[model samples]
Target: MSGIAKTPEPPYYAVIFASQRTEGDRGYGIMADKMVELAYQQEGFLGVESARDEGLGITVSYWESLEAIKNWKEHSAHKIAQDRGKAEWYAIFSLRVCKVERHSFFEM
Candidate 1:
């Protein structure tokens, strides 16, 4: 996303995915875009922010609840992408789901 995600107040969720990419694109770009598009259509999806530098990437996707995060994990297309990531796109990855108790934002 272009800027930080605009999420609701406390009590929502964030799925933080941090990864070390493999050498080449290997279809990763297409799948990443598709996943973001699909995420915007899923129930309870809030917003997303992503960044990458060198071979490392971080994507934090906001959600209305833990169930919503779980549903996204089990989504058929996302599952396929996850498998492909393990096999070809990511050298290492970590996924953390956490409750967002509070937040702050600033703009100028």
Candidate 2:
């Protein structure tokens, strides 16, 4: 099945993160790529979308369960990055997790 087909129907979870970086990203690009790769290898991870410009970034990741989301949150490397975000990388940020009961997409 395609990646889109694997997305769970209704009642899935999304982790939305919005951030403003503090300075030059330095190793951020590489780390972000690695993080995406790691997340895809994780059990229950559905998909991810990210975009950034002028020090602002947004990342949204889909998951199968709350437990999976929690596991990702507690991941050691992710925790280290989270600390870096708070202390040095990010000027401001917010994380929101929502239960998605329904969605739709169209392409032309």
Candidate 3:
């Protein structure tokens, strides 16, 4: 996306997905777009911010709770995307889920 996500007050959760992409798109772009759209329809979705350059990509998705995050992880379509990411899209990846106890923002 363009700007940083506008999130609510702290005490939510964040899923940090960091990856090094493989060569070529290989349907990854379409799937990624679909996943983001689907995420917006899921329960407890707060917001998401993503960026990619060269081979590296990082996406942080905000959620209302741990259970909400787990639900999204187990979502059938998302599971398919996960498998495809490992099998075709990413050269290497790391995912981290964390409790956001505090946050800050600035604008000009």
Pick the TM-score winner. 1
Candidate 1 lDDT by residue in tens digits, 1-108: 668898888889999999999898989899999999999999999999999999789999999998899899999999999999999999999999999999999999
Clash number for every model? Answer: 0, 0, 0
> Lowest summed lDDT over 10 consecutive residues: which window, candidate 1?
1-10
Q: Give the top-scoring candidate (lDDT).
A: 3
What is the C-alpha local distance difference test score of each model? 0.94, 0.83, 0.94
What TM-scores do the predictions have?
0.97, 0.88, 0.96
Please state the error at residue 107 of candidate 2 in Å: 1.7
Instruction: Give the C-alpha miss distance for residue 70 in model 2, angstroms.
Output: 0.3
- Tell me the tens digit of each residue's lDDT in model 2 across 41-83: 8888999877778977888899999999999999998887778
| Superposed model 2: Cα runs more than 4 Å off | 1-6
Weakest 10 consecutive residues, lDDT, candidate 2? 1-10
